[model samples]
Target: MALKTSCPCCGKPFSAPEDYAGKKVNCPKCDHRFVLKTREQALQEAADLEAEKLRQLEDRRRIELIEREERKHRDRRASMPYYEKFQTGTRPVRNYDPRSGPGFLNLRYLADLLLIGAYAVLMLALAGLGLTVYLKFAGVISSIVILSIVLIGWILVGGVLFLLLKYLAELALLMASLGDQQNDVVRLLLDLRDNTDVDSPEQG
Candidate 1:
C-alpha cells in the first residue's frame, strides 16, 4: 500500500513508500528538491524551523539596537566641552541682572565725574594765575610764554580728563559685556538642566 507524504518545497500531497526516510524528492508544482516526509510531520518541522529563525533574527536586532545606543552615549560623553570636566564646584562663577539697578551710579562712574570736575577747576586756575607772569615778558617772549603756558595747561587738563573718561568708559563697557556673558551662561546652564531632568528618571 502507498503511504501518504508531503513535498517539503511545495506542500503537495503524494504517495510514497513508508521506508523512504531522508529520501530526496522533487516538488511537482515548483520543480524544487526536498526530502519526503508525512504531511503533518513536514508542516510541524517547517513551522519549528521558521520560529527558530525568527527568534535568532529578533535577538540580533535587539543586540544591534543596544550597541547603537551605547555608541551614541559614548560619543555624546566624548564631545562634551573641555571646561565641563575641570569645573568641580556647582556654584556659578558670575551672576548678572540687567534690570536690578542702574549702572551709572557706581563708584567708578562717580570717580570719573569727580576727576572731570577737578580737571575743569585746575584749567581755570592755571589760566587765571599765569596771565600776569605771561604779560611781563617782551613781545615775542611774552607771546611765546603765554601761548606755551596756555597750551600746556590745556593739554594737561584736557589730556588727563580725556584719559580718565576713556578709561571709565572702557570699564563700563567691559562690565556690561561681562554681565551679558554671565547671563548667557546662566541661561544655557538652566536649559541644560531642564533637558537633563526631562530625559533622566532620577531627580535631584
Candidate 2:
C-alpha cells in the first residue's frame, strides 16, 4: 500500500510508498516538490520508532532473566543425589564408617550389622530344625502332615521377626524423609520468589 497525496499548488494527485512518508518528492504534472508526510507525522513516527526499540530491549532482557533462572533451578536439581533416586530406581550405596559419623549413628550401624548376622544364624538353625523334624517323623507320619507342621512353625517365627525388623527401619526412614520434605518446601518457596524488580518500557 502507498500514501495518497496531491500536489498542493496544482491540485494534481499522486501516490507515494509508505516508506517514502517523510522524504521529499516531485509532482509528475507540474514538477512541484513536497514532503509525503507532514512535519508532525514525521516527528510522531520517530518517537514511535524509539519507543518500539525500548520495548524490544526490555523484552529481550526479561527473556534472558527467565532463562538464567531456569538453568540455575535445573542444575541445582540435577546435582541433588536424593532427586536422582526416582530416575535411577535405586539408592546409591555409601559405606558406613563408624569413625566418620556420630557415635550414636555408628552404634546403630554396628547394631544393624550384628542383627543381620544373628538373623543369618537363626535362618540356618531353622533349616536345621526342618531337617530334624523330617528325620524324626520320616517313618512315623505322613509326608504332608510333617511338611505342614514345619511350614507353619517357620512362618509364625519368621514373619514376626521380619515384621519387627522392617517396621523399625521403615519408620526411621519415613521420619527423616518428612524432615527433608519440609526443608524442600521452604527452599522451593525461596527459589520461586521474584526478587528482581524489572520495570517495563514506558511508551511515550
Candidate 3:
C-alpha cells in the first residue's frame, strides 16, 4: 500500500511506499532533492526552521536601526555652518599638514614636545647649580632655605609650562583626527563622483 505525504521541496502532495523513509527523492515542481521522513519529524523540523528565520530577521532590523542613527549624525555634521563647524572642532581647521611626515616628525607636535623638554632641562639645571653655589658660599641652614625657595619657584614654572603644553598637544591631536576624517570624506566623495552616472541624477 502507498502512504500519502507532502514533498518538502515543492509542497505537492504525493503517494509513496512507507518503506521510502530515509530515502532520497526529487520533487516534481522544483526538482529539489530531500530525504523522506515521518510526518511528526517533518513537523518538528519545520517549526525549528521557522524560528531560526524569525531570529535572523529581528537581527537584521536592529542593525538597520543602528545604521540609520549613524547616517543622521553624518547628515547633521554636513549641514552645520562653517563657523559653527570650526568652533565644534569637526572642521579641518589646522594650519599645518599632518600627512607629510612620520608621527614624531609632525612639526607642531614636535614643537610642543620641545617646549616641555626645554622647561624640564632648565628647571633641573637651575636647581642643581643654585643648591651647589649656596652650599659652598653659606652655612647648611642658609643653603636649605635658598633651596626651598628655588624648589617652589621651579614647581610654579613647571606647572604653568605643563598646562600650556597639554593644551597645545590636545589641539594637535584633535586637528590630526579631524584631518584624517576629512580625507576619508573626500575620498568617498571622489568615488561617488567617478562611479555615479551623470545622465541619471535621480538614481544617485
TM-score of each: 0.31, 0.34, 0.36
Backbone collision tally, model 2: 0
- Candidate 1, 129-170: lDDT as tens digits: 466345544343456566677667766776676667666666
lDDT of candidate 2 over 1-204, digit per residue (tens): 677778878989788778777788989999999988854685787699899999999999999999999999898876765424223223342222112323345435555655675576568658857775776676644576766787677767776676666556555555555655565555444433422245889999
- Checking candidate 1 for backbone clashes, the offending pairs are none
Q: Model 2: which ten-residue window has the lowest total lDDT?
A: 93-102
Model 3 TM-score, 2 decimals: 0.36
Worst 10 residues of 3 by lDDT: 96-105
- Ordered by lDDT, highest first, the candidates read 3, 2, 1
Residue 14 in model 2: shift from native, Å?
18
Off by over 4 Å in 2: 1-53, 62-100, 114-143, 168-204
Best by lDDT: 3
- Mind giving the per-residue lDDT tens digits that candidate 3 earns over 113-193? 756775675677567667756675676546667667766776667666666766666677667667666765665455445
Ranking by TM-score: 3, 2, 1
User: Which TM-score value belongs to model 2?
Assistant: 0.34
lDDT for model 3, on a 0 to 1 scale? 0.65
Alpha-carbon local distance difference test for all models: 0.62, 0.64, 0.65
RMSD of 3: 15.5
Give the C-alpha miss distance for residue 37 in model 2, angstroms.
Answer: 15
